[model samples]
Target: MTTTASYEQLKLLKQFIDESKTIIFYGGAGTSTESGIPDYRSKHGVWTAMTRDGFDPVKYANPQFIKKYPEKFFAKNEERDNRPVPEPNATHKILANWEQSGKDVRIITQNVDGLHQKAGHRYVLELHGHHRLWHCMSCQREYLSEEVKRDEDNIPRCFVCEGIVRPNVVYFGENASKDTVGKARRSMKAADLLIIAGTSLTTPLAKRLIYDFEGDKIVVINLNEVNISPLKADLFIQDWVGEVMTTLSEMN
Candidate 1:
């Protein structure tokens, strides 16, 4: 279902980027699909696969579940931690390049993979938190994911205080970090251009933050239709995010 963008459309996109001084790139899981990461809500995504296997991500990926069943929680996290690391794709590289070229670019992403940082983007706001960061619940001591995974027990314990060690991600019942949200909101509101890419716009947080954008131009790049009512995109391209962004990067 991927469609090719016309030459005129590509020119217009480049024009938008060139004319804007401040830009914000808001992205989702689909942004990293080209890097071998699976999105959550797509037809062949992690959610569908997990559901098919009788694993309820909604129930298990929650704070209450972690508190009630620490062993099960750690088991699931261990599985996640063992997955191969994904590399940055074209979109990530392009955005990082834009920032390096002094385009005043910032990224606000729902992904926890940290690919943006790997691509050398310094101003990234991760709304969902990162899997690679862990902390001791009791001592508030920070630990790398590898450190926690080294534990022999199913439930990871802090070496310092024998307290439970948990990922710094925002679970289903937990709220996102207020500092991150506030910074993202300010960036969106102050941006002259906003690019919404690789997302279906399904999450409430994504929608809410996007609505705060007071930008003059909005561009959406996704293979599927996005229905962000009242806040329509100036340009909507139904295509692969990496493809479109790669093309954009090539333009003058």
Candidate 2:
């Protein structure tokens, strides 16, 4: 249990999941923040480094620019953020285990850390892609996440084509993988309950996905208030995600 969770709250949480058959857990960068992965939009994030470097993150990952001067972008990436060793937190593990019980409908995440997948969540719709895996832009050859991790470079490259390898993640202007978005929408529409944790509900599709669900049951756990309007979440707890999900898992 987290520092904030009470026995009463735990009971309420257990009851919440118990009644819902089809559940979809939507999360954001905040979901992996506790695991030591800095969310790019947070106060202490890669964006701050980009500011010091005198360029916006939006411009940095531009497709045209990346293809034009790949070396510069790749080099800057190496200097800026090469620390990608963040592991799955307790929350990630529990969510994955929840799926093992055949109860978790789907885990829709905005994070690129690939923690949930590593934790063994079988049904996942990674809307924004993940940082762990990489693919050759030229040949479009897929590489295992471990292959990227073994390489010390920030921007992991493809050995065969020697082309610029991009993380599977969706950049600022880049579109998401059509397959991923489709699955997320389908799962969300079928959800009886939506448990959202560790997200500000800010940024592109994070908040918009909530609108897909017509069901009244929505649970949100965030450290700060989300940008969206109105007191509509069925359960809102401003707290740490790792602790909350860990507590909820132990209830059953």
Candidate 3:
């Protein structure tokens, strides 16, 4: 159901890319959709389905929930467990290629999927924690993706202290650390061009960060026009991110 960018838009995007120096990419779930990851706010997103079933997905993702009800917090949902592992697509690859080519390019992502890193981007600031990280609530010991074990209840436990293990991601009730937010803000402040892709601007923090950028060009590429309406971006392209980025990369 998605489409590619038009010729005019592609030409315009390429012009912006060629002119800018310090470029920063602000991305969300949509950035990963080309690799088979679903956006969390979409009609078929994880949060959407949970909300339809009368469950507040954010509450379940909260750190407070884990503190209050460790059992329920650690309870495994088959849906989350069975989520398809996605690879980085053209957008991620193109951005990484830009960074590798000595451009002052940085990535600020709201996704925890780690696809950007997998795509070989070195300067990625993950606003949300990664899914692969597991840490002990008590000792604060970190566990790799393979080290953690699940119990009969599917609750992950720490190997050393037998304490509850939690994902490193930021939940709805919890705000990102000041350091993390500061890093993202710094990148925005330095950017000559800001490319926002695949996000609906639903998160207040994301909106604040985007508006805070005093950049030369603010470009938004997405699959829908509705998400970018309030943005007032210098350039708005309603198309698949990977397609647009691929075309831009080729032109560059």
Candidate 4:
């Protein structure tokens, strides 16, 4: 399903990669869609499904919701933990190869899936935190996701402080990790080319980070149009991230 226009855009992206010494791959939920993960804003995504069920996904996924309805929150977490783990797709492999091949590449992702690291990417900044990691709310002790399974009452408790244990993800209405954000900002400022992929830039923090890039060029590849004002993409490809990345790899 690769169109001629998409090939042309791939050529441009290749040229950008060739010219730039430092590159940043800023990714979102759509980056994992090819790996059987659903995006948040897409029509059939998590948000849409929540809305269809008469629930506000943002409210339901918030940290406050965890306190107000511990059982419900933990139940949702249990369900998510029970789902099959998704594997890294072409996009992740391509980016990881770029980094391994000595292309000064860094990844700044808004996804909690940890697919980038799963694909052997070393320089990844998880802006949204990771789901595979868990932490105690009171003791701040960390644990792997598997170590903190919910009990029969649908509550995962920290063994040390007997406190609530939650995934190490930045929920809606929660501030992102300042350390991660600062590191990402530094990478953006140092990058010569920034590739915005798989995201509509709907999240305010993600949008703000995009604006922080004082890079030489910006390349956007997504299945939808990106309408961020005052910031025009040097190359925009309205296509699948995996397809675009796969083609780009082939070009090289």
Q: lDDT tens digits, residues 15-61, model 3?
A: 88889889989898888887887778888887887788776887877
The model with the greater lDDT, 3 or 4, is: 4
lDDT of 1 by residue, 2-112 (tens): 449887888999999999999999999879999888899888888788788897989978877776788877776667657787889989998999899888999999999
Model 2 ranges with Cα > 4 A deviation = 5-7, 79-84, 145-162
lDDT of 2 by residue, 129-149 (tens): 876677888899988756753
- Relative to the true structure, how large is the alpha-carbon lDDT of every model? 0.87, 0.76, 0.82, 0.87
Instruction: Extract clashing residue pairs from model 1.
Output: none
State the weakest 10-residue window (summed lDDT) of model 4: 1-10
Which parts of model 1 are misplaced by more than 4 Å?
1-3
Model 1 TM: 0.93
Provide the global lDDT of candidate 3 against the true structure.
0.82
Clashing pairs in 3: none
Which whole-number lDDT from 0 to 100 does residue 24 have in model 2?
A: 85
